[model samples]
Target: MERKKLTLLQTVFTAGVFSAVSFWYGFMFGRESARKELGGLIEDLRRGTAGSEPTPRSS
Candidate 1:
């Protein structure tokens, strides 16, 4: 019947849409975690450099 075919098509379309959205969310999550880790590493380097510097003496 035509109704059965239409139902099957709708089901397939819904599944595809859900899969695409899920993939997008997972990608965003991974990107954000990487950004945070890199930022933390840069901050640590800055702190280390600052601590190792010698102070200037004025006459």
Candidate 2:
């Protein structure tokens, strides 16, 4: 009974650790992707071509 309990505890601990690590990795990847997308948008705005619609000319 003692050995079985210890094994169960160890298995749960390992699974928790694995879940935490995977979550961290996914968060980091999502952040990096957003950063890259934002950079591209900024560059487009700077170039005066943010979207397909043309900017209106004001006389």
RMSD of each: 10.6, 8.3
Candidate maximizing lDDT = 2
Cα distance off (Å), candidate 2, residue 44: 0.6
Off by over 4 Å in 1: 49-59
Count clashing residue pairs in model 2.
0
* Model 2, span 1-59: residue lDDT tens: 99999999999999999999999999999998888777777777999898766544322
Per-residue CA lDDT of model 1 for 1-59, tens digit only, reads 99999999999999999999999999999998888777766776877854555444322
Off by over 4 Å in 2: 53-59
Global CA lDDT computed for model 1: 0.80
* lDDT scores in order: 0.80, 0.84
